[model samples]
Target: MAVNLAHFALNADDIPTSRAFYEKVFGWSFVPWGPPGFYHIRTGAEDAPVQGALQQRRELIAGRRTIAPECTFTVEDVEATARAVVAAGGRILMDRFTISGVGHLIFFEDPAGNAIGAMQSDADAE
Candidate 1:
């Protein structure tokens, strides 16, 4: 099972404000990507720089705000991982969905209620 933390995203109520804060504090670069109000984050690291994003906030589970940064792990199989989450006492917050060029992805909350994501990368996905 591939469990590498592949990506991290900050869910912000104010994208512009959050973008500026991160930029001023960390010197990270933000590039508009994907949909409107979403930006890809780039940390100027010489070593292993992880991918990140800044996007408009949304409820992970009905009426519950995602207050913490959610991270996604690279998995070999999204569906299998989702099943494992349920069996391990976690709840699925979002079902599998295709992200076009990205892959099949799913969102779930851990036993402690931390929102997480898992993705089976497939560049050819559509």
Candidate 2:
């Protein structure tokens, strides 16, 4: 049941502009993800290097301003962990869903209202 910090995502009203800014400022490269309007960010080449993503603000939460960057943690079992989240008093904002080749993901808010993501990779599920 070892959970590891997996990725981070930044919500942007304008995907291209925000992507350009990060590319220029941080020199990060991006690859198109499975879903349209989502891009996977590459920050470094280290083993288990922390990765990130740029997503449309509207895609994140409806009628809410973008807050802090969202952090995604990798879990061994998304469904079990999602249940654990509710048992621990956290609220699930998004239910488990597959990302094609990526994996399964769920979004939830902690007791303090901070948004977080959980991912269970396809490889790990097998």
Q: Report, for all candidates in order, the number of backbone clashes.
A: 0, 0
- Top candidate when judged by TM-score against the true structure: 1
**Compared with the true structure, what per-residue lDDT tens digits does model 1 show for residues 1-126?**
548988999999999999999999998999999899999999747597888999999898888988889899999999999999999999999999999999999999898878899999999999
Candidate 1 clashes between residue pairs 3 or more apart in a chain or in different chains: none
Question: What residue runs in model 2 are displaced by over 4 Å at the alpha carbon?
Answer: 59-62, 124-126
RMSD (CA, Å), each prediction:
1.4, 2.3
What residue pairs are clashing in model 2?
Answer: none
Question: How much RMSD separates candidate 2 from the native structure?
Answer: 2.3
lDDT of each: 0.91, 0.85
